[model samples]
Target: MNQPSTPASWRMWLASGQPRTLGIIAQTISTVISLMCALLFLAIAFGWYMDPLLALHLFLGAILCLAFIHRTGNPLGTKNMTFAGALLALLSIACCGYLVFEQGRLSERLPVLDPLTDLDLVVSVVLLILVLEATRRCIGMTLVVLVSVFLMYGIWGDQIDGPFYHRALSLEEMADHLVFTTEGLFGPALDVAALLVFVFVIFGALFDRFGGGNFFHDIAQSLVGNQHGAPAKVSVISSALYGSVSGSPTADVVTTGSFTIPLMVRDGFSKVRASAIEAAASTGGSLLPPVMGSAAFLMSDFTGIAYSEIIIAAVFPAVFYFFCVYMSVNNHAMRHNLGASNKNQLPRFWHVLRKDWAYLVPLITIIWAVLALNRPAFAAALACLGMLPVFLTKSQYRQGFFKNLIKGLAKGVERVILVGVACAAAGLVVGTLSMTDLTGKISSAMFALASGSYVLTIITAVAVIVILGMGMPVPAVYALSAVLAAPALIALGTDVLSAHLFIVYFCALSAITPPVAVAAFAAASISGSNPMVIAVTACRIGLIAFIIPLIFLIRPELLLQGSPTDIIATITSTLIGCWALSGVTEGYLLGHLSKASRWLLAILTALIFIANSWISLAIGLCTLIFIYARRHQAQR
Candidate 1:
């Protein structure tokens, strides 16, 4: 008999496995590095620094091991590769280590009588670029390509033809950017990755391995598996639960999709519909609170707001998102005559709960810890370690618990590597902008374009964030956008949390935006649907993505920044908006809606529900009354 093939076998079959293990492992390490970076930042924030040398040693050791051990089949000779990898890894680690342990010591490395005398600057620049290359190898060519374009723009400013162009950088100046400064590789993106986002990423991974995600799935299945459009409802509940922890749409897709997609298909949903539902719902995870797609980290860091505030503010908008999705699926289910499978066929809720009851412990523990302590990073880290005991009690799984525990730890280490390195690389952009006062120039240019219209300025800013975000991953996108857009929002009178959340939402949702919808494309690939169709469907299903950002801007109370009364009013209004929008978009509220009615209802709902002002609400109410009158007249 033939033996079962491994992931390597499938890769060979597809002719695309060259970076499979390494890529996954690199991503995993990048997540952990992000967490550690955050911890170091917390230390800085709290005034307790880790030793620079120790942090450097820890980072370098992990990188060298991954680069050498995992890159064995690549072109480089083992010995040469080992030496180069170790050198680069150590250098990159040194940069972060210094930042964490020697917060004020970086000035010593700055150019003095001779700018070339800056040893730290030179080493860091070279190492940062090397890290960028590694990230490119692991993820894709897009980010590297985009960063390269920016670097080229920086250097060729004088030679450029466009009005926006500036003077080019000398090699030394480029080094100042790519290595020593905060803009290029160590900018806000890296700062968040290192200090805020990493812990959540680790929390996500641990949540999965410790059965948190599965627990969510089981609970969702039990709650809605017997309802009309049960599959889609499962998608809703499961996605929200998973989203709270996972923080990435694509990660949510793969996690929940592994089970939900097949189940949807089996239950009379088309491949396209099933994939679209999962894609849309999974994307919401980034918008969901707590972990919140790692955007919360960047938001807090960028706006100088507390993580708790961001979480609290985001709660209502996220609920609106899930509610819209839930309504969409339900309406479609009714319209199409879809219903739950035979009762006996559904998973036994009590049994599933009993079997997986313990999985809830970790998530509950993490939530309680975060709320009680008001420390998101430490809460996540502690939660990650705490999940292990729950796994050890099962005899069936206990034998390998220690091995898996080590593997999990190693996985954590590997997950953050690229993020760490990439942040260091991207810091070039930030460092250069700060050191040269280029960000101010760019900001001035943007403000110039606005001339005076705050709304246009906001629209223009959102456009910029979306465009830049197209090239970077979710975390990087949020980090970059928060820096550029948050200020614009603040200038427009948006509160701190609302402004940051607005940009962060757009950046995260950019994963499903057109032309570069990575998350949608990934799901489409699995569902074998046209990528564009998946993208459009995803955008439609996640309509809240487009509106929620605007709503928060319109009413900061939507993000829970106002008094209790205001908060209640904002949330109530938003839910009404969500339901009306859902009725409009999905073409159903109480029953099946005609195409004309759907269009009219959708418009009326948006106008009435979202326009929380009394005048708009009154108009919306009259419109709704007219619609009902028309429906009754038609029936008669």
Candidate 2:
């Protein structure tokens, strides 16, 4: 008997590496074909080819799904399973590719079950299966199960009795609506990813290639490396600068914490505390402006908010968050008397600026484009790439400029796989919610659960999303929150962007929450601290973020929603609240706090949030005086 034939996927995957010249030619051909198709859509779509445009978009989405599945590998099982997955992916692609090939030919009958072409329905069911399976392999069973539960709800919603139930969609109709319409797999959620995010990622990766991560660390260290508790402070500043762009908290922790954590350990921080500090600082990276990871991009699509407005609203909170971390690090240093070096021993701030100031141009230009020129996000990012060539003007980066540039672009495309996969999975959730009308149903139900009290409703929404956020990627959490928790809060009369951002803030914090904190776990690997311990410790050090959402919720002004005076007052009040809370929680302030002083600090924190303006300020004043007097007495 003839030997069993190996699958083509295995041959292609394996052969991709060998016969190097032929492989290069093949890859080049594939790239040309993809570009031609892309250009075709661009030309036609601009000329009002709506049906073909949408068909092409959907078609490309299917290809993306397949690519992600292949790249991520069939982690759930072996080669046999991987083969089965590739087969499903191809089938899904064929279904979509057919539409691209015959864009306007099947206009009326598309996705509807007819005697002639029930293939659309068949294709859709399989495609949904493939998406769920792909989600399982890439993300895990949690999101897959969540998507499945929603699928069931869309199918059998009418049969269920309750406010949550909606008239169920017919099987054919559900498949058609999901596969063919913009609301389903290729909806706004995916559009944001397809159009905007990958461009940003590629540009950022290139930016990183020229040594941006190290540059920021160098600047941060030179500025604060000799401060009391310099190591902890260094971790705070460097991680923030790096995380602001890198966006993956775990990756950020591993990259920066490897350096910062060891430095802190030598400087007298317990391994656990050092790890926790790095984990917490890196966890806040996604909240920083300019990138804020994929969440900000998704927010722009979900809330119909402008990217500039989103970044602006995030400014105070991000600053406050890092400031709080800085304070905690300072207290830890003072308590331990960690650093004794003066400014003379540290790198001159001006000297470091002179060296790395060139890298600042691209960052500043990107920001200026987004805010001042109001250029499109993708174009703004692409423009940043222009700076990469300029960096080669330096003698050091000159030798490997082309090589480093290629590596960055290739790595950027690889990174896109993970983000693209998450975005597509999120689209499925968005699709299901749209088809079932379950998003509105949940929003209404939440309003009832809180008895129509605005504060209660907001609190309930945050609580629910935070629980769901556990054990998930930041992108997944933010995506799920867009449809679930955010709608509820927005329904309760919250500012639209503020409400959306509140969900993001809480979801971002889950990276440091216990049980399955990704960032903390990464830090644990570096510091050898208990992951759980690091996670809990991160929560305390990160108390600033936990409180920020609540502040911005009640005072939308801080989200750039109100007059300048209102913004200033709320921000000042919030600053005082954070300072007091961090002092009490970390057990340090101007000096070691007595029990009475801790109580006083706790009371002041409550006053900032609950009391009237004058009263809160009065309390803030009193707290400031108390700190001054305590420090003075200690000196005596």
Candidate 3:
């Protein structure tokens, strides 16, 4: 027979020859990374300083991402690739450990090792290549290509000979700057990942593996299960709650949509629409507080703001986004008579809460520590985590408590490694900007390109963020965009909070953005609908949520920064804006909206968004009265 094609031939040879070995090796490395993380987390939770912890995280990241290359592989895999992977993993552990051991010497402000150790130089070059390869394997070729372009720019910036050009730098100088300093791979991005984001991610994993999902279900069902479109509404609320913890929108969909989507279809919704609602609601979860996952922690690092302050700032937009989804589902219910269960059949909210109310104590503790005590992110999460053992006292949780606890801890470790690796990869981009001072160049380019139109600049910023976010996870996308795109907004007078959340909002939306909508794709797998169809529907269903950041930009008060009166006013108008916006998008109000009316409602909503607070409030109130009156009258 003719030789198989390259992909098939590779698979055949790999399957027969090296499959089990690579698989075993990858699993073994992943487990070790998990174990290392356990040690590191315990070390920090017990009150150690963060300097050494950073080194341990980076070390595990290097080893884990390299081994992921073996697990996830490339076309170039060979018997040699496996050997090379093992060698790289071992050397990486040694190299990153060396950096950690010598962090005092490798300080960002300290003098470079002028000549550089031969071993350091070799490790830097080899480790950089391996990191690039690992980034390719775990993230995508796009990031690898983007980082390569930055590396090239940092090295050869002098040749450009323009306002953007920099002085000549030798290869050794570049390597020293990129490797031995915090200017590159072990910078703020990784620092935040190690210090805060990793801990929260572990806490989230632990919460989920313990019983967070069931609590969300009980709570959501109590609130909306008797309403019209109960299934969709439940998805909205539950996804928002659970999504806050599980920042991966696609994973959230698979977890909750497995329950919500089927019920929606059985309750008179189409598969596409059901999937769209779940995907959109799930997408907003990462924007929710507690663990806005990586973006929120990084925001704290980037803004030099306290994590508690960031949490407070984040609450209104997150609530407003979910409110928009809840309204859309409520509107659809009115239009289709969708959500009614017999009151008798539904679980009583109080009864459910009383039964598993213990499950909520951890989250409540976390929120209280953040909002009330102003504890740091890690401390807040750790406080809640410590209370989890309290659940073991209950008979319902006693069995398998230790078993699930260990598994949850392991899952957290695995997740942090992924985040750690991504952060290291992000640091490459950050380092290039700092080393070459390219941020100023790029910001100048954007300013010139926008020609001073603030709206166009903000739009361009969002587009850049969305495009960058298309294939990468939100944190990686946010990290890159914070360096690349967020400056455009800041240059145009957007505040740091607005600029950061502005990027984060779009990155979360990317889960339902077309062409590469990962959450919609997961929903499609469940609903058996076309992913593109689901994505488009999701954009329409959640379209109002898309404008929320803009609303915040229009009125900073919406971010909870201004006076209580201003904050309350902005929130009231925005909530009303959401009602009109969602009504327009769903083509429903109290009852089905005429097409022309939807257009009118949409235009009026946009105007409400840009108007002065009083005017916006007036318009918002009028729009709400109009929709609510029509629906209420029709019901009568």
In terms of lDDT, the best-performing candidate is 3
Candidate 3 ranges with C-alpha deviation above 4 Å: 1-29, 50-70, 74-88, 101-113, 339-345, 387-390, 394-396, 628-636
Task: Please give, for residues 462-578, the per-residue lDDT of candidate 2 as tens digits.
Answer: 777877776676777888887888877776677888888988888899889877687998999998889999999999999888878877777777786778776677777778877
Better of 1 and 2 by lDDT: 2
Return the clash pairs for model 3, or none: 227-339, 228-339, 229-338, 229-339
Total residue pair clashes for candidate 2: 0
* lDDT for each residue of candidate 3 in 1-636, tens digit (9 for 90 to 100): 866468766544333122223456566666566666765755675476666545544655454544443434544345333665566667667766666666665554444545776776786787787677666655556667778888898888899977889988777787887776666776778777776676677777777777778879878888888889988999999998888887778778999999999999999999999999999999888889877756888887787777777777889888878888888888877887775766787888899877777776777777776677664554645554654654564565577776676677667776665567677777888888887888877777777878989987887777777777775677877888888777778867888888888888898788899888989999999999999999999998878667888888878888887788877778888888887887887787767888777887888798788887778888888887777777687788
TM-score of each: 0.83, 0.86, 0.90
Better of 1 and 2 by TM-score: 2
Q: Highest TM-score, which number?
A: 3
lDDT of 2 at 365: 71
* lDDT by residue for model 1 (1-636), tens: 988977765443322112333455445554465455444543543436764334443444345335433433233223223455445555556654554554455556654233654565666555656555565544445566656766666766668565555665677777655544444554566656655566666657655665667678778878888888898889889988887887778778877887888888887888878888888888888888888877787677766777877787788788888898898888788878788956676678898877776676667777787778787777777676667656765554477775655555555545555455445445555665554455666666678889958878888888988887763566777666666666766776777777778887888778778877877777777778876777788788888778888877887777766687766666765666677677777677666677888787767767754565554546555665765787677678
> What lDDT, from 0 to 1, does candidate 2 have?
0.72
Candidate 2 stretches with Cα past 4 Å from truth are 1-96, 106-116, 340-346, 612-614
Task: Return the lDDT, model 3, position 187.
Answer: 76
lDDT to native, each model: 0.67, 0.72, 0.76
RMSD of 2: 5.6
Worst 10 residues of 2 by lDDT: 13-22
